[model samples]
Target: MIEIHAKTSAANTGSASDRLHTLGLALPDLRGNPYYVHHRTVDSSIYISGQLPYQDGRLLGQGIVGRDVELETARELARHAALNALAAAVQAVGELDRVRIVQMLVFVASTPDFGEQSNVANAASDLLIEVLGENGRHARTAIGVAGLPLNSPVEIQMVCTAV
Candidate 1:
């Protein structure tokens, strides 16, 4: 795992793995055509839109939160969400090292009584910290929604700092 210092700098002197270990996370695969671009902004922020679970032109899994999907499934879906976010980051910055995650908002589709949103959100957080080190740590919010696009169990969106 890479360790990253919180010092705001563009050069990635820290190991990506160190950052992952710091957050107890792993790098997720960049799959699907999921990504985002920064709007015209003078600040160093990149707005990554919501990412859903998808691959090979198909949604990975979809259903009610406590129905066909379990908590672990939600976690995995969260990883995919981060993977897509990374793709967006790389597309914007040309490299992961030039990017730092600033914030994440996760949406989970669940029943009114099913409440394990934070557990699933951590999967994305861990992956981000692993891939971007200290830059990955950011403010986050996880909420349960009645539904997501294509009935997906989870959707994750992010904001990032880019050089």
Candidate 2:
């Protein structure tokens, strides 16, 4: 249950709706208030929950990063996670332009020997830069984990500002 930061008045409504249509994106069916999603107010920001490497509604791969999942595969997983985050952003704000991705937190499920969280997280960060241009640049955190929900390879969460 995400709250609209922008007020109900027409003055607060901007090109967000139009941008959504132009981008051909829509909100997904949310079960409840996402741990990673939030909106303070118009011109405030949108927070998206960390997303896993899920495709076709299921996690693509799992296990230690270097052992079971290859680096390239982990990178791809992060990319998908980033895309999921974009979807969440659009849904939370009703538009993408009213967004300034402030930061990204990436978590990688890996074994003790795997220490490439930055590299893996880059996949998600790079995708955001490509999709949002300069607006995607922001502070980020990449962490290695013992495991993730459903044993996914990568997970990414984002914070975005909107008006």
Candidate 3:
């Protein structure tokens, strides 16, 4: 059982959606959110909005990455934010396997001295590939910010190709 970094990756078969389930994970319910729509489709492209690390309606890692929050915690938050972005992709495309990730942008709210933004973003990158395989691989940018909405520590956005 080669862990996917954070308590997953025991099996390596099936579609990305199936692999998601095999890893004991489920996409969040983005049914009727009043904040903002998760994604929009233009032609064959899905433009996903920035997603924060919210699990079961509770925000996680609400602090600076290098100050109050540790590196591993921030990385896990990035992974969860990416998962949320994946959910947005599915919502727009109707199926996870039907689309391919094109690009990703990760935001980390951290201290000015922190320099591991890419390392934190790697958690998202690693999980995407672990679940979606080649289709999940994508061009990415990781940036450190002084602050984010709701004081969350990490956020992620994705662009996917659909239909």
Candidate 4:
């Protein structure tokens, strides 16, 4: 179960973190250690490494977003990637409430005919907004790609301000 932080009211009417928990989503464990770090911070800004739709170290969806993977599935994977990004941000800053999402770059693996990158990205955007309220709003770019690492359907990376 995901833990709802106390500072989520300004992001939504209810708690965004609580919404996430009710959706049955859980943040992935950050694989950072002394040797390798998943996120880095400079001043109050935290840069989260690219996150895939992974849980328990396994990539969730495989194949191209508009081909082998359906749009809905890709969207769901995007949500997972968003969760992973949030996990990284929270891990780096020590609290979810301290995170103010600044930007998100979403990449979707797609076929030549696919053109719904924005719709797919909305899955992540909506989730972030629901979880963090105003702090979750951020500039975003959605790009369709030929492929992605680990054959995953989507990948996401983010920048956040830790207050």
Top candidate by lDDT? 3
Estimate, for each residue in 13-71, the C-alpha lDDT of model 2 and write its tens digit: 33544433444544334334555343333447676777776656667787779889999
Off by over 4 Å in 4: 1-11, 14-16, 33-36
**Candidate 1 vs 3: which has more TM-score:** 3
Model 4, residue 45: distance off in Å is: 1.4
Tell me the whole-model lDDT of each prediction, alpha carbons only: 0.73, 0.70, 0.86, 0.85
Is 2 or 4 the stronger prediction by TM-score?
4
Off by over 4 Å in 3: 1-12
Per-residue lDDT tens digits of candidate 3, residues 25-125?
Answer: 99997555797789988888889999999888889768888998999999999989998899889888889887688999999999999999999998898
Residue pairs in collision within model 2: 1-33, 36-48, 36-49, 37-47, 43-163, 46-160
What tens digits encode model 1's per-residue C-alpha lDDT throughout 1-163? 2323333232245665454445454434454443434222246777876878766456888988887799998899888777777667766677767777878999999888888899889877766755665677899999999999889999988888785
Superposed by TM-score, candidate 1 places the C-alpha of residue 135 at a distance from the truth, in angstroms, of 0.9
Q: Could you tell me the lDDT of residue 134 within candidate 2?
A: 55
Q: Estimated TM-score per prediction?
A: 0.76, 0.74, 0.90, 0.87
Give the C-alpha lDDT of model 1: 0.73
Candidate 2 vs candidate 3, lDDT winner: 3
lDDT per residue for candidate 4 within 1-163, as digits (tens), equals 1322333443466555666676677677866547657788998889988899988977887999777999999999999999999999988878777789999999999998899999999889888977787789899999999999889889999999986
The residue pairs in collision within model 3 are: none
State the displacement of the C-alpha of residue 24, model 4, in Å, after optimal TM-score superposition: 3.0
lDDT of 4 at 145: 96
Residue 55 lDDT in model 4? 82
